[model samples]
Target chain A: MDEQTALGLIGDRLAAAGDDCAVVDGQVITTDMLHERTDFPAGTTRYTAGWRAVGASLSDVAAMGATATAAVAVYAAPEFDGTELGAFLDGATAVCDAVGAEYVGGDLDGHDEFTVATTALGETDDPVRRSGAEPGDALCVTGSLGRTAAAIRLFDRGDIEAANELFRFTPRVAAGRALSPYASAMLDSSDGLARSVHQLVGASDCGAALTGPLPIDERVDEVAEDDADRRELGVFFGEDFELVCAIPEAELGPARDVTHCRLHRVGTVTESGVTHDGDPLPDRGYSH
Target chain B: MDEQTALGLIGDRLAAAGDDCAVVDGQVITTDMLHERTDFPAGTTRYTAGWRAVGASLSDVAAMGATATAAVAVYAAPEFDGTELGAFLDGATAVCDAVGAEYVGGDLDGHDEFTVATTALGETDDPVRRSGAEPGDALCVTGSLGRTAAAIRLFDRGDIEAANELFRFTPRVAAGRALSPYASAMLDSSDGLARSVHQLVGASDCGAALTGPLPIDERVDEVAEDDADRRELGVFFGEDFELVCAIPEAELGPARDVTHCRLHRVGTVTESGVTHDGDPLPDRGYSH
Candidate 1:
């Protein structure tokens, strides 16, 4: 079974499983699994691994427009090196501190490959759902795209420091909280911009038209072969951990004013059929 | 670094990292990691693996005397077998239902081995801790021990069905809640009775003397080589998932009246030194 099929199975049994975070008693909880083979690149440090893995779950809490409270991670590796373990905890702590959350301690175990599973908890009274977008809602995104794409390229080129730095993208917790009151729907763009749009539109039973130019990160120019590659990096490559939200056109100004992060008006929710520049937008992006 | 060293490092950075479950704003949270090689034996069903793994974290919540609210797991395996995945979810859901908690769902990823990391969230206004035991407090235990030890032996003897049944020991969530009002300190005996007693005593700055007969499960007779082996299995082998608590002598009656599980007055807290039946009780048990 694949992730979608697995999710379907889970959803059949659990009514609260499909959302970015499972909200219980006004608390948003989310978990993520990242393995060495699938997540950490060849040159990645344990610290970067720690930050990226924990931040991924924090982003889910952010997606719910919640106030992140604390996070814990289960770290598993074949053996534990004191320096590496300390660095990993340092990174996890740094990320939690950066997002105004606490990094509580977690369990450690032995495994053949290094793996980290993280859970983030947050509190919220009114959570923005993915199913609330209206026909005239303005589609927006926070932060530029293609940071992870550029990071991967830099890693391939042996630029370990820059790659790790790029991997440490900020989770959009503040942006999500700012947009919660005004936005009709919100979700993290960890699954890439195109797929995020598809998910938001599908959940709302609506469509979207991307009329504005994609906010491609400048770093993409350093790695892309051409404009097409740059576009692919921005639109298809994920791990940006940015927020893609749908705000009423009338509320967009206030939402933008409240958010400290860069906010881009990327498109507009439509009555039907997703498109960009008059062309169909395929539902495709990162999986795992 | 070992688990202890890693934990010490984490403790230096995260003040709330050393407790059974991190309590924040009247909520309790915990995470646990289990691997295929170290956790599951040959012939162990995916369902049993799911139950034991998720239940481990739930046990932590119980230790905190919290009402379990919800749980999520991160499942990673080389391939996602539909049958295995379905059975795992079934077991996870069943365990949560048994404890009045929701198995809200989790994430899936591909890894070289079958591994699971679970997180359970709970709530309680007056959370229990390991540092509340005092001199003259009664050291009590809920349920019997040696269940997992016998199960492992039975599994080795090719009794898969019986072994799985034994492995499905109930987490003492209700009992913990009942004792929370009166007990001085409490924690699940996942690390075995000896280690648990030592931990409780160490945390509370006291000692204990176990005078009553060890509540060894009857099934151990079928597997143990002799009385000595039975005693070892009962006291040293862990994974009982029972509760070892310290309660004032005056409150023992009320605690027993409220808890539905079998309650045993195994010992009394002392000013210093740990012993069992006039012999020194070594501080040792399951490590991972």
Candidate 2:
């Protein structure tokens, strides 16, 4: 089965499954799966892998506007090296500590390749969902984009330290909480801005129009071939782990004042058709 | 690092990391990882794989004496077959239905070999822990043992139907709940009866002595060469998914009355040393 078909099947069977995090009795939960070949580059450290893998699930919790409580991971590898395992746990713990959550221990198993599956738990009385955007809501995003794009370039150039630093972007838990009260709809931009906007509007039965410049990370220019390449990286390449949300225009100022991260109003939710500067935007981004 | 050393490291780092399921507030959560090479034999169907993989985590929730609420799985395969994927989800949903929990949807990815990582969530006011066992407690088990052992033998002889049926054992969630008020310490017998007893004692600073005959499943007689072989299968071979618990002798009768499954008194918690029929039982069973 293709990914879309499989997802459709899942949606058919599980009513509470398609959201970024499933809410049960005011507790939010999400899981992510990452493998060595797909998620980790040749020069990536196990520590970065651990951080990035667990962070993916944490990002989901943030999208729901919940207070992250703890996370657990099932780590599978061909062999267990003391140093590597310690470093991985250190990274996992460090990321959890970064957000004031706990990195609870999980199961271990041996496999032919390294794989990590992580689940994060959080709490909230009211979780923001992807289906709440209004036609006139302002589309906004937290932080600059293209961090992973820049990290991949640095990794390709053998700059492991720089790449690792870029790979460890913070999950937007605080920003999500700050915007929870006013935001009409919310989701993490792990699937790239374009795809995220598409998904947000898709869920809300709305469209979006981008009128402002894309929030490209400054570092992306260092590796980009041209302005178009930089824009592509910013709009299409994902793993930024930023929040993409829609808020009522009247409430955007209050939302901005409360958010800890840089919040930018990039577009407006529309009644029909996604567009960027009068041109239709393609619904494409990182998947699987 | 070896498994023991790694577990010790985890224990040192996270205070809430070593239990069968970590409890946050009143919620209990656990995760498990399984790989094609290590977990699935040649004749194993995707349906059984789905049931067993998710069942493992559900069993952990049961061990904590929690009411399982939901489960999710990350399913990775070299290629997704529509029929196979449907069967897998069907089995997952079926197992959750069996336990009165929801099998919420999970992520999907591609890998060289099939792999699954699952997480189960539950709720309980008074959660049981492996560290609560005490001397003079009665050691008891739910249902019969050696089911997986007999299943493996059947699979070796190409009895795929019977093997799959055996692989789909109950998670013992109800029994765990019934024993919660009385069981001092409880865990599922996935690690084999002998290793489970050793773990129960090790966690609670107690020992055990098996005075009665092992609860060997009658099906074991079909594959065993003699009574000794049947006993070994019941004692050492794992994956039975039955509850092995320590209950105060005074409360054992009440626990037995409430439990829906067949309960049997197998041994007694002692001051020191694990023994069976006046002989020291070796501390060994399934690992990884």
DockQ values, each candidate: 0.76, 0.74
Error of 1 at B97 (Å): 1.5
- Candidate 1 lDDT, B138-233, residue by residue in tens: 999999999999999999999999999999867889998999999999998988999899989988999999996888899988899999999889
lDDT of 2 by residue, B141-177 (tens): 9999999999988888999999999989879999988
TM-score of chain A of each: 0.98, 0.98
In candidate 1, position A181 carries an lDDT of 96
Q: Among all windows of ten consecutive residues in candidate 2 chain A, which has the lowest summed lDDT?
A: A3-12
Model 2 residue runs over 4 Å out of place are none
Model 2 TM-score, 2 decimals:
0.97
B47: Cα error in model 2, Å: 2.6
User: Scored by CA lDDT, what does every candidate get?
Assistant: 0.90, 0.89
Best by DockQ: 1
DockQ of 2: 0.74
